[model samples]
Target: MKFLFIAPRFHNNQYYWVKSLTDHNHEVRFWVWRKEPLENYSALTPSLIPRSSFGLPKILSCYREMKALDPDIVVVRDPRSFLFVFVSMLIARMQKRKVFIYSQTPLYQTMSWVKKITVRLMLRFFGSLWITPIIGDMRYPKFHPRAFYVPFAIEPQAQEKSPVRRPIRIISVGKIYQERKNHLLLLEAFYDSLKKSDIRLTIIGALSGNSPEYFNKMRVYIKKYDLEQTVEIKTNLEHNEVLREYAKHDLFVLPSSNEPLAYSPLEAMGAGLPVICSDTNGFRWYVKDGENGYIFKSEDVSDLKDKVSLAIPRLQEMSKNSLNSVKQFYTPKSFYEKFMEAVQSV
Candidate 1:
């Protein structure tokens, strides 16, 4: 089947989804708001089409491309790019083509009544909605009547069983939208949790452009709490380097106060490290408290500290569970099949 994907950036999550469909013998085409140099990431090829920066040019280009492809399915990734995607789908529909959206976010963070009604109206036309949650408990927009939960998947790796816990190395991975993910609380919890233990923390991810103030604020707190040695703050690393960090670490923590479903924890699990995340949708699904990993209160430092302390002792068992869980549920093959199921349903 031919599939067309429109997203803000053709990297990371969007790239993964597109690649999954393509590998499954489905033709996948993408048009994004902008394109980075191909060298910015791996597994990205020359096939993904480029579109306008935004506005009318992007809408026209996307519609024109979709019309040319006449795909079996048209999927939009980012909500911000939905304006063009909606128009493209309407144009595609005019040609009797099916349209859908595959996303992890809702229409709004907390929808006002009017916005809720608007979303209900908007969703009515979507043929399918695909979401990947760490957990499957999210209350997605109404158009999700045909919604499918296809959790994030990771490439397989050799799993080394931890026989006994030694130094407790902790790692946090993902784009550093610290406030959205509540990295400040994580920094605080990491500092407090390590006070009586031999654990160390390393944060690996790109800080969002809007987070300079938060980064500076975190710096002040790190200095004040003397956590410079305990918590190492760094910038973007290659995906494998991030995986290496996961292998080196005993625990992975992402205190996203409000997360739909995050991909990092699943990747960490693939590396055989136990995860601790907020009690959000994604965490609720995979983390079975003592089974695979721990789930702390979304924004509560005390709860995060408590859960971290609980997880430290069972590090070996949790690591094993983490790897086992990922193998069972979050593989690329499974994701591809699940996605195809959704699209075929459309």
Candidate 2:
């Protein structure tokens, strides 16, 4: 099968899918809007028409690429690529090809009517298939029959069998923003429960370019609580370095509120660390609450503190369960199998 993907940018997760498809003898090409190099995939960066210019050149470029590739399947990954997807759908219809849309955006009942109508029209008339990472996302109105769920996959690493540290190392990885990630809540919970205990906290993430205020707020909170000695805040580490940091930690905590599906916890699990995250994340689908990890109420510092306190003692058992869970459900090989099944069904 010949597959072409239209994506906003290159992501680490996409590498597994591309490699799997190629391994299965499928010719895959990626058209990315961002002018960045992808390590091993056959990816191209096409010139995009600025929105101020009415987007005709962008549509033309996409159409030309679609005609040239002539793929059996076209996967669209960004909602902002609707114009490109619409053009591809038209060409696919004439050539009897299939197109699939990868939706990671969180849809909620509080969305504007205009946005809802636009989504309905896109799925109803233009989209050939809808692929979502979470099952709950497939419950949108007018999404049956075409919607399919596929779990996100990561490359499994050889985890080191190390004894749990005495001063428990807890780590959280995400953008250092309080609104989306609720890092302050985690800080509060850590202070309330584990400050006096033999536990240390490490917050790792890139500071948002637009929001230095939130980053400053985190620094102030750390200073106010005199946690400078017990807590560490590291920013802007390379991907491999981040993974190494995960290995150094004993447990992972994700206190994010309103996340679509976070990859950090999955990476943590792959690194053989037990996870304690908010129940709001879509990836909680794999968390068997108290089996592999624990899930606390979103934004509830008290509940988070209780969950963290309970999980600290059971780290070794939970760590084993976490490894087994990733092997059973979140591996790249399993993802490829499920993706192939979905393609055959379509």
Candidate 3:
């Protein structure tokens, strides 16, 4: 069967899902709201095609193009992405085709009344399936009639990590955004941990173009404590290169409070590294407290630091648990099966 995917962007994990479908002997054509790839992300193959215009023109242009492509099933990223959803659903239903809405809607966030009504109306008439990547209870607020969950797939590593190294290297990957990514909060917690134990931290992410204020602030804080040797900050590593860096560390921490879903923690878990993330991470379920890793209270420096201390001794055990936990569910084979089930169910 032919599947057409339209999304705002082709994120790293997004590529894996598409790859899953293609590997299962299906044809897929991916489209995006923009033509260019993200700052540090690239498509796996058969590059993403961008929508041509804005407003009605975009809907019409894409509607015409999708009709031309003539897919067996149309899969869109989000219901909120009206152009893609609207056109895909309308056109697909017109041809008696099926639609899958890849709605990674966060349970933490509430939908506006206008959007709620709009989405319900679309699903009611056009008959689309609501598919989400975010798993566990943190998914959208149990609203969709036929909602299906598909955890984002990853290529997990088979190698297990060595025993925890002193100066237990903890790594966090995200953009340097103080308000969202919470780099400063992590730095403060890491600094507090330093007084008690010998631990090292390596931060990896992309940077804003110029006047990287948050990056500079983190640098200043490191300078203030003379921690340049222990706490290393790296920027602009490719996705695969980031995985190589993950192999060098024993722990993964994503301190962001408002992350809808993060790929880093999942990727780290897939690589046999124990993960510690904030309570609010949408994929927080992947980190089983006291088993695979810990989940600290959001923005609590002491709590975050304490979890790190607790994890130090059992890092290897948790590493095994992390591998056991993630590999069972978040694999490409799992995605292919689940996606096909959703398609057949509809």
RMSD to native for every prediction?
A: 3.8, 4.0, 3.1
**Candidate 2 C-alpha lDDT tens digits along 1-346:** 9988766655655766777778878888876645432223332223332232554425555566667778989787745455654555565666666778787644322447786676667666666666766655324543445666676776666764388978889999988855688888888989954558888899998775677898888899999988988889998776677878988898999999888788788889988888888888876776879987899999898899888878888999888888888888878788888777778877
Residues 255-316 of candidate 3 have per-residue lDDT tens digits of 99977788888889888988998988876766789999999999898899899889888999
lDDT of each: 0.68, 0.74, 0.77
Error of 2 at 106 (Å): 9.4
Please report, as a residue range, the 10-residue window in candidate 2 with the lowest summed lDDT. 43-52
Where in model 3 is the C-alpha error above 4 Å? 35-43, 46-60, 81-89, 94-96, 106-119, 138-142
Quote the positional error of residue 156 for candidate 3 in Å: 1.6
Q: Which residue pairs show collisions in model 1? A: 134-282, 135-281, 135-282, 135-285
Largest TM-score belongs to which candidate? Answer: 3
- Candidate 1 regions exceeding 4 Å error are 35-40, 45-54, 78-81, 105-135, 138-145, 208-211
Cα error, residue 117 of model 1, in Å, equals: 6.2
Error of 1 at 168 (Å): 1.0
lDDT score for candidate 1 against the true structure: 0.68
Candidate 3 whole-model C-alpha lDDT, 0 to 1: 0.77
